[model samples]
Target: MNQVEHVANLARLQLSREELERLSTQLSRILAYMEELNAVDTAGIPGTTSVVAGDANVLREDEVQPSLSQDQALRNAPDAVDGLFQVPQIISDR
Candidate 1:
């Protein structure tokens, strides 16, 4: 009956002696805010890319567009013949 009531009775949870005294003061203030984020310093930082690092290799211009004309691409076939497109009998002419 101690360590947060032995972790609220191995988590079958039924807290309320004021929610185990307010969850042990909110788990010691979330472990003192994770020990103040384990003290940061990030030295010699060179891990950056594109905070507007645009225009380093943008080249586009090989143009050749005009497609679709074989009778307006077989004019939406429901089963075309001489201009092709009639599929339905999937496998087994064995």
Candidate 2:
């Protein structure tokens, strides 16, 4: 089996002869472009982990605040009993 066939099998794909030929050419071109990129000189250039380039995390101070109680929270629930939200039973005995 060829590289295309091998890759198709590994990916659980069923490709026609025309599709296999087309994809093989496309993959070959992609690999060639990667090889060309690898030949470029990147000396002295710092590697970038992200495009944004900064610490993303910014947190606010945690403080006590007035919020909804259990009754208020469960007011919109389709099913609620006492102060708890109820959901349909999903498990069944075999």
Best by lDDT: 2
The clash count for each model shown is 0, 0
**Candidate that would win on TM-score:** 2
Candidate 2 lDDT, 1-94, residue by residue in tens: 3999999999999999999999989999898888987778999989877778584876788988889988889999999997898898789777
Q: What pairs collide in candidate 2?
A: none
Position 14, candidate 1: lDDT: 84
lDDT of 1 by residue, 9-39 (tens): 8988988898899889999889888897558
TM-scores of the candidates in the order shown? 0.21, 0.40
How does residue 26 of candidate 2 score in lDDT?
A: 94
User: Candidate 2 regions off by >4 Å?
Assistant: 40-94
RMSD of each: 19.6, 8.8
Worst 10 residues of 2 by lDDT: 49-58
